[model samples]
Structure formats: structure tokens, C-alpha cells
Target: MLLKELSALASPLNDQQIGQLQKTVADLSPQQLAWISGYFWGLSQTPAAAGATPQPLAAAVATAAKPAGKLTIIYASQTGNAKGVAKSLEAAAQADGIEVSLYSADDYKPRDLAKETHLVIVASTNGEGEPPDNAISLHEFLQSKKAPKLDKLQYAVLGLGDSSYEFFCQTGKDFDTFLSKLGAKAITPRIDCDVDYEGDAERWRSDVLGKVKETIGGGASEVVVPLHAATSVGTASAYSKQNPYTAELVANQKITGRDSGKDVRHIEIDLGESGLTYQPGDALGVYYTNSPALADEILAKAGLTGDETVEVAGESLTLRQALIEKFEITASNPQQVAAFAELSGSKKLQKLAEDKDKLRQYANNTQVADVLGEKKTKLTAEQLVGLLRKLTPRLYSIASSQEEVGEEVHLTVGLVEFKNGDNTRVGGASGFLAQRAEESGEVKVFIEHNDNFKLPADDDAPVIMVGPGTGIAPFRAFLQERDARGAEGKNWLFFGDRTFTQDFLYQVEWQKYLKDGVLTEIDLAFSRDQAEKVYVQDKLLAKGQAVWQWLQDGAYLYICGDATRMAKDVHEALITVIEQHGGKSREDAENYLNELRKAKRYQKDVY
Candidate 1:
């Protein structure tokens, strides 16, 4: 009778379950009921095997595993590449009956490091060998005085980075080294991967999983959790990075003035009911066709007909089509340059390639066409393809939120154009989006979601955005999103460029936003406007007192710009402001900022 009354909400629980629930709670008070509610909530959020401990937080991070052995998968990604690889590995391991947990480096507490039986770190190195933002705390913790010995820990590392950089996989190398120094066992050697990291990452994952399976005595759970199987929010789209949606280009207008040194386009693409929705800070991946003119030049220089069929990555296509759609023809790196030099047998080129410094300088300044144009070598299509890396899609920070733009996605694309000797060269994607393609033409695209960079969940929290040059892209989306949501959080922006008159992008909308009171304050730094070149950091120092006050008031500080110089300079400036206004020692100021980073008050999206 009581069971029948409890089914008022149309809960499908049978009489037995209802009776069990009633029996368990019949003698309990309201306090006990609340406690029981929370207990079951945790149980639901963390599902484990009958005897195992369910992981905490969300299902994305952990899975229930046997006490004896549980595999841990952790990723420190600047972009979504390493996270994607880690998730794929997590799903695979679960499918193979291996109990596993997946964690973003920031979320995984350092204290639990020693308790882990098996560990795999998939880390991506950011600009100049720096660890990704999420990994900063963990990386520093491991290197600090309070670091613990991991005598029983067995770990493996997979580093994702571009070989073009001097320290290709420095972050991952550091992690592996730190763990090893702390007495952790390395089950497998560290593998540093270049831009095309999929194959190597997969191989490393397989090897690590196999090693864990052999070492661990307890078996995996029969019922597995599928975390990455579907989109966490909204409707899961059929399209993804691997299988992208065919979106048509609707608009590609030059946002920057013609006189400006930069060529930035405000591009719009029609989603057309792809049902792919994205957050403000997410990136849009675009797969573009290479320049036809450049492709023709390569074929002519190689003395090959366009009709010749070539095999690449187990696919057969006409050489001309491959050059246009598949191969990377515009840029050449040291590896590509050295490989070409060896094949062509040019004595001068071989001599230059032998010298690392000269080769790097030569490769950075030249292109594949230049190499082919220099030497007269009769090469087969297959041989030529072997020398070049595959064409990878470019990712641009989205400039418009779906909340404001609806089905159309907007991007602020900065074209990379320069003179390479006698010929003009441009970035593959930028040139295609800005010059070669028409408005009605279709482009393959997908969303690269970033969880690390986001507006505070608390809509009332203030935001301080520092984005200069083309980095202003995502901040545009942020402001648009805040406006659409009617979020009362104060918005402060610091934007810089060469000249405000010619290079101030989205000036009209910002003015309107300011007039509408959506933006609380705006600061501009035109580097060439005065006798003394003033950048964003100078503006920061000038208003250092106010900036420090904002920090004390719990404002979220965000920076998106060039990582090499601007970010470093601004970081030092922030520290100086903290020390000057907050009145702390240099070391204390550093610690304060580190704490802010840990609290997610300071976030960056630098390349």
C-alpha cells in the first residue's frame, strides 16, 4: 500500500525496490534522509563494480576498479589533441576488460599519485617547452620540496608536440624524468610524437595497456563505462574531428584595414543543421585544399605528370589530386628538408642539411617548392610523397558563440603571407579561407572543445580579458555570450595592436557594447602611436593598482595572445603588479599567482 503511494512520480521501481527503500528509511529522521540522498547521489555519479571503489567528481575522470590494480590515464593538453588520444585509450582499455580512470592533469590531486598502481601520462608541450596550463600545478608539485617518493608507482609517458620546435617533447620528457627520479618504474620508454601523433600515440597506448594487463592481478569490470562515447552536453552530433561536417562558407570579409600590416578575415560558415553546438572558447577545425598553383609547381619541378597515380597512407590517388588535397606543399621543416636533400643528392643541399643550425634556418625560411626548384631531380610520385608530411587541418579560435550567432559559426582568421625569395607564400588554411575560396564554397569543419578555458560557472563573477592582435577572437565570443545571457558580471578588456586607427578590430561592436554598459572598461595600447612603444603590458602596469584590486575581488583573469614574448612579458607584469600593490615579497607574489592559477582565477589560451 505504501509502495503504491510512493510511485506518484511514475518511477519504474518495482514493489521489491520500493519495499527495500522504505525499510531502509522507515526508522530514519529527516537528517538521515538527507544523508541517504547524498550517499545515493554519489553512488549514482560514481558507478563501480560490486566490490570496487567508484571514482569521484564526474565519470569523465574516473571509473570503479578493483583495489589490487586500476589503470590511470592522465592527459595534459594545450589543445584537445592529447585529451582525445587519452580518451580513446581509456575507452579501448575499458573495452578490453581493464579497469581504468581518466583525468585532466589539473583535476587529479597530487596526493593520490603514490596510491596509483598503473599510470599513463599523455602530455602535450606548449610554446618553448612549457607545460600546458592545466599541468602547471602538478608539474611544480612534483618538482617541489614536499614531493613524495613513488617507489611503487609504474608509469609510462606519451608526449605530443611539433618537431619543428627545438624542444619537441620537453614537457613529457620532464614528467617521465621527474617520476623516474622519484623512484617510479617506467614500464615502457617515453615516445615523443610530432604533429602527426595519432599512429605513435596509438602504438604507445597499446603497449602500455598490454604491460598493465600482464602486471595487474585483478581483472577488469564486466560492465564498462562509456565516458567519451557521446557529447556531454546538448545533442551528440554525428560529425567530429575525424568525420567533419561539410559546412558552406557564407561570409569572408576583411575585418582589418587594408593599410594594416595584418590581414584578418571575419569569416562565417553555415552549419546547416549539423546540430554541432560549441562553447565560447572552443576552436573550429578547418580542412582546406592546398593551393593549385603551388601543387602544379611541385609537379613541374619534379618532372612528373599530374596524371600519375601515387600511394600514400595506403590510399591511391592521382598525383595532382594528392598534391592539392593530401600532401603538405607550402612549408618545409628540417626533417623534410634533410629527407629531400638526401634523395636529390645535391652536394650543396646535403652539406647545408648536415649542419643543424643552417638546416633549421634554411628550412624555416624556405618552402618545398624552393627545394624542388633548386635541384633538377627526376623523382617518382611515391618518392616525393615520402619526403613530405601529411596535410593537417588548422584550428582557429571561434569568434562567435552559438548563443549569439545561432547555426552559423564565425572565425577571425589571420592570414600568414610573406615573400619567400621571388615567390609569394601563404598559410594553407588562411590563404584558402581568405583568398582562394568563395562564399558559397563548402569547407570541411569540426569543433575542438576546450574545457580548460571557459567562463566561470558563476555568471555573476567578473572577467578580465587580455587579448591582443588576432587573439581577440575568443574574447569576442565571450563578450557576445555574456551579453546574450544578460550576465551582470563586469567585463574588463585590454586589447593592443600596432595602430588603433588601422588595426582596431570590431571597433563598432565594442563601442556599442560599451555604450550599452555590457562592457565595464576597455583599455587600448597602440604600440606605434607615440614616441615610446606601449604594449598591453604597459597598460597593465599603468593600471596595476586596479588590476590588483580586481584580483582581490575574485575576477577571472584571461590572456590570449602570442606565447613567445607578449605572454611572458605580461606574466612578469602581473607579478610586478601583485608585488607592488599587494605588497608582498617576489617569492610570495609568485606563490599568490600560482594559487590563483590553481583556483582557476588565471587562465590563458596562448599559442
Candidate 2:
């Protein structure tokens, strides 16, 4: 009987909680089980009952009544992509006369899942097969023994992931499985999308909307829900990802030392009274053209004339212009290779295409011209346009605060460089911003707002910022904004780079701020300065006590930089510091960190 009871409850408890519960309740009686359940239920119900003191009965009734024919959209986003998709879907759904409610996975309580009728999950998988940070708790709850049955719920999932990963869209798969196990009906099968997810996501949305209409017994006629419309208020005046504003480049200066291997630029673009507004943590999206010389090489190698008219997506333009402003030329995809090899019918190209590994390697190094040069082929302008993907904007972290710089936008760009068979190649956006764009020349740009990364509202709150390399961009803005506001906050910064002499970015400004008493503390870590490798993590451990004291004193911690190594190492270092300084165990320290995250004390702007 006890085993059966345990098994019944196992489905509702998380992996960790279930293990603990099982150990504690192994010898408990059925009466004890009932009593524990009652106790928890009472605890959960207390808040609602407490409201009876002053609330009217009508208020209680209104709360109990659910909105009719409403769509609940939940987004599990790791890097804001899924959140963008979810916002788009909500706009579409609202336009169709369906009421919509949006929630981040972390913000929504698991107990409320049972109240949902129409559910849509927009989820993105993290590195490997991990669920996004926001989705972890809800994901655990859905697979736990305490999960409520959802037999009446109609659901659909849209999973965003990169095909390059081994476990592509694993989080979506998990959600689908858990929903099915809980007896929820699938309104539509889950769709897993790769990097170019816009088309796939649109198709899935249409399918889901159709299912939602049928399930709710609504007619084929489109329903408009005015309340669900996307907000047009406070939109930036400049160009954005969808419709970019062309802003003139006012200045571009090389900031790095000449002897340094890296080339970093301090770029300034004139918003030109566009009334474009951007905060400190926002990123500027730059849409750039491929190098003209490279385009000429491609056209010549392909045996095609640049003047040929090509019709793409109902627009006719010269092949050269299309290649220059519209199509992607730097990166190559597998689909393009397969399509081109089949079109050319070259024996050598066909042989290379036979091996996926070889094809990928060739595609990575060689451009369209190099590939086409290997075989002589006559291609129509339309075919050429079809073979190429659309040009996407690159996001560079904004290095200046609007509060400090006004209309001008500043960026600390590290130009990309690599040797290709004795020839130096640079990334399109970085090179264009650094070398091609002239002073006072127009460059289309926009702002991408990041709400997840923000400064604390309290002026006096202490802040710890750890940023190395290009990751120091936003922190620059933070310090500027704080200084401009005359904030009383004590700011501590841990900045690392190659060498202090050559690579210490914004050195003069930092020194000025230190002298002005705006910056309370500064920790410098130059990895290549010493014989053995030394990073920010090393400095963090050295000052663990002070760091812990700052945290204890209600300091907000911020991390910006390399997502792969730096972020991971810094996180481990934080855990170690917390454990050592707070005299807590490893697990307790992790929970403490998690609490900081939940409280919005720990923030990361990592890429």
C-alpha cells in the first residue's frame, strides 16, 4: 500500500524532491500521507483565504472566472530568440480576434498550468540538450510526481534550435513528451526549427491557429482582439531588424595598440536627429554589404555578368546590387552546396558533395566565387538569387549610454580576422565598420532592447561587474549612466584582457572615473601578462571575502563576456567564493546563487 502511494506521488515530485520524500516517508502510514497532503493544501490555500478580510465577494468571483477563448503563450528563451518569436505569435493571435496572455516560463507558476485551456510553448534549447534558464523549474515540475493532469488542454510547441548541435530541439521534445504523459491533447505536432527559423515558425503558427479555432468551436472567420495587439508606443525612430534606419557614420578610430595582434575600433554613428532612443544595455544591429572586390571575384568566377537582372521575391534588381545589399556572401550553408553541385553537374564538385564532412570544410573556407570557379557553369540571375540567403544584421554591444552621449551611438568592435591560404579575410560587418565606411557615410542600424540585463533601480545599491574583452561594452555604458545620474551606488569592476598596457579599453575614462570617486573599486586581470594563465576567476578567488561582503551588503552582480568559458569559470568561482566566505556547503551556495538570479541580483549579458 505504501509502495503504491509512493508511486502515485512520484509523478508529482521533482527528481530531487522525490528522492528526499521517498527516504523520509518510507515508513509512514496512510494516515500520515493524508495528513501531509492536507497540510500542504492548507498552506497553498492560505493566501486566498487571507484576502477575505477586505475583498468583496464579486472580486473573488471575478478572479475565479476565466477568460473565454483566450490563448496562453509561454516562451522559454535562452538568448531572447524564442521571446521574440513568442511576442510575434501573440501579436498575430490577437490580430485574429483571439485573446492572448504571454508569460516567461520562469514567471509563471506551475500550479497555474491546470487552469490553462489553450497552450502554446515557444522554447529554445541551450548548449547541448539543456532547457533554457527560465524553463528549468517548470520543466522539472512537469516531469515531477506533483504535476497535474491536463486531459482537457489543447497544446502545441514550437522549438527553436541550431542544427549544428547534436541534440537539436531536445527541450521541445521533452515538453511534448511530458504534456502527452499528463494526458494533454496535441493540437498540432511540435515543429523543430534550425537557425533560419522564421519560415518554419510562421507555418507552425498558422497550423496552431487553425487548430485553436477548431478546438474552441469558432468559425473560420478571423477574430480580432484589440487588446492583444502589439504595442507601437515608444518605438525607436531609426532602422531596426525589420526596417532599419540608415544613420551616417560620424567617426571610426582604431583604439588598439599597433603592436597588438587584435584590431579594435571605437566607432561613432550619428543618429541624425532621428529621435532614436537606446538604453545602456541595448545592442546596435548593423546591416552591411559584402566587399565589392569579393563580389566581382564571385561574378567573374561564376562566368556571370554583374549587370544581369535578377527577380527575387517579386523584385527585380541587377545581380551585383542583389549580391551586394541583399544576399549573404560570407557564410555558406550545406543546402547551397547541394543545390549548386546538382545545378553545375561538375564531376569534382559532385565528388566533394558526396562527403558531407568534406563539403562542410570546403564551404567554410571557400566563397561562392571559389566554388563556382572550380567548375564552369552558366547561371541565370534568378537561380543565383535563389541560391543565396538573405543578408542578416549583426548585433554589436552598444558601448555608450544615451544619457551620456545623447543621439550618438558608440561601439567597441573587435574586427574579425583569419588567414585563408595566405590571404587575410575579415568579417563583413566588422570590416565594413572598421575599414569601408567613411566619416559621415550612412550605415543602416537599429537597437535591440535587453530587459533581462539592467542596472539596479536603487541608486545606492552596490554593483559588481565582471567583463573581459568585448564583453566590457555594456559595463562601459553602465558606468557612464551611473555617473551621469549622480548615482550613489558603489561600483566595482573586474576587467581582463591580453595586456594592461595595450588592451586596457577605455583606460583614460576609467582613470578619470576612479579619480572622480564614481568607481569604488577596480580589479585588473591580464591573462597573457604572467607566465601561467590568469583570468578574472583568479582575481575573484583572491578577493572572495570582499566579494562575499559586497553580496551580503545587497550588491547586484553583473557578468558580461564570453558565454562558453569565461561565464562558466566565473560562475564556478562565484560558487566557490560563496561557499568559502559564507561557510555554506556546495549545494547551499548553488541555491544562494539561484536565489540571487531569481531576485534579479545576478545578471548576465553573455553571448
Best by lDDT: 1
lDDT of each: 0.83, 0.79
Error of 1 at 312 (Å): 2.8
**Candidate 2 lDDT over residue span 208-292, tens digit each:** 9877856543212454323213422245453445667888898888877878778889889988877778887777889898888
TM-score of 1: 0.84
lDDT of 1: 0.83
Error of 1 at 244 (Å): 0.4
Q: Least accurate stretch of 10 residues (summed lDDT) in model 1? A: 57-66
- Model 1 misplaced stretches (Cα beyond 4 Å): 1-68, 217-235, 344-362, 374-376
> How does residue 151 of candidate 1 score in lDDT?
93
